[model samples]
Target: MDVRFQTGSKRFNYRAAGILIEQDHVLLHKQVDDKYWALPGGRVKLGEQARDTVVREMKEELGYEVHVDHTPWIAENFFHYDGHDYHELGFYCTLISNQSYFQKGPYHGLEGERLIYQWIPINELNEIVVQPEFLTAGLRRVPEHTEHVIVEN
Candidate 1:
C-alpha cells in the first residue's frame, strides 16, 4: 500500500515525480478537476528505491520506458489541498527518453483516469499553478547536483 495517511489536521504522503523535458517544454499532468499541475509519477511503493519508482511510474502512466538520468531535486512539500493540509516527501528526478512513444496528444492515465499531458514551455512556468513552487521557478535547467528543498504552504 502507499505510505499515505490522514489525521485530524494533516495528510502525509511519500511520493516520487519525474521531470521530462522535450523541445524546450516540460511535460506536466493537468487533471481537469485539479487546481494545480502535477508531475508524471505516483506514490513510492514500499520496498522500492526512489529511482526505480520513477522508472516504474513512467511506464505505468505513459506506457513507455524512461531512463532516470539523475536526482535533480528532493523536496519536503507542505501545502493545502481542498480542505486538508498536506505534508509530502517528494523525489523529483530528471527522465531521459531513449525514443519517442509516438502517441498522439492527450494520453490516458494508467490509474483509471483519463488524464491530459500538457507540454508547457519553460518560459511560461508562471502561467499555471504548479505545486512545490521550487519547480516552476527552477525547472528550466535541472541542477547538476542533487539538492533538498522545502516548501511550506
Candidate 2:
C-alpha cells in the first residue's frame, strides 16, 4: 500500500507492538542499517485482532509462542519519522516459550538483511536510538496497570 503524506497533512497508521520483558530487559530487534531498535510486532492485518497479530508476529519473528495476557500498556503514539506518520499501539506480553529459529521475514535491515534478535535493558533504550514513540510512550513503567493514551495529530 502506498501511504500519501502531504505537507502538514496528518495521517494515521495503525500498528501493534509487543513488550516482552524478561529479567528487566526487553526484547528488541536491531536493523542492520539503522542504529534504532524496534519491538517484535508489526501492522495488524485486515480482519485480524490486535492480540492475535502480536501472537502471530512473535511466533513468526522470534520463533517462539507468546501469550498476550492483557490489554494495551501503551496506546496511540503519534510520531513522524523518515517522512511518514505513525500511530502505534504497544501491548504488554509474556514470553511463554523458550525457543529460537530463523526464517524469512519483513523489515529488512540496512543492507537489506534480516535482523538477528536480542534482548536489551530498558535503561539502554537511549543508546540504541529506538523509535520516538517507543522511547516516549511505550516504555513507561506501570505496575499491573495497563493504560491507553491517545496521541493528537
Candidate 3:
C-alpha cells in the first residue's frame, strides 16, 4: 500500500517525515547497517494525507503518539541507492509528543533492533552525516514558511 513504484531500474516514492526536537536535540534513525541518519518517518500509504502519515509512522516505529505541529518542507529528491535510481517526494513535518521516555537518549524502536533511534543535539548535527545533506545546516534554522527543496545526489 505504500506510494511507491519501480520500473526498469528507476523508482519513485512518496514519503512523509517527522521532525521531533526537544531539549536542543532532534530525533534521527537509521537501519542497523546504514551509515547515514534521517528524520523518523516512512512511506506514505495510498489515500493517506501526508500529515496522517507522520502520525502513523511515529506510532508504528517508536510507539509514540504524535501530533503534527506544522509542515516545513516538501522535498523532491533524486538519488541512487541500493542499485536503483530513485525520485522521491517527501513531506517534512514538525511533530510534538507527550511521551517522557523519549528523553532517555537512544533506543531501538518497536520493530525490534533493526532500526536505531537517537536524539542528536542540534548543535552537533553538523558532525554527522544526515541524508539530503541540506538538513545538516538547514535543520539549525527551520524556515518559518513552508519551503520546497530539490536535491540531486
Task: Give the best candidate by lDDT.
Answer: 3
TM-score for each prediction? Answer: 0.90, 0.67, 0.96
Off by over 4 Å in 1: 101-107, 111-114
Candidate 2 lDDT score at position 13: 52
- Candidate 2: tens digits of C-alpha lDDT, residues 1-153: 322234464555555667777665667776566666767677677677777778887767655677776654566667766677665554444444454333333344333356746667667666666653434335656346666666544
Which window of ten consecutive residues has the lowest lDDT sum in model 2? 101-110
Report the C-alpha displacement of residue 114, candidate 3, in angstroms: 1.2
Report model 3's TM-score to 2 decimal places. Answer: 0.96
Candidate 3, 54-149: lDDT as tens digits: 999999988898899988899999999999999999999998877753566668988999988999999999888999788888899988789999
* Per-residue lDDT over 45-103 for candidate 1, one digit per residue giving the tens place of the 0 to 100 score: 88888888889988887776898998988999998877899999999989998886433
Global lDDT for candidate 1? 0.83
Sorting all predicted structures by TM-score, with the top scorer first, yields 3, 1, 2
Q: Give the candidate number with the greatest TM-score.
A: 3
User: When superposed on Cα atoms, how far off is each prediction in RMSD?
Assistant: 1.8, 5.4, 1.1
Off by over 4 Å in 2: 1-11, 89-95, 98-112, 133-140, 151-153
Cα lDDT of candidate 3 equals 0.91
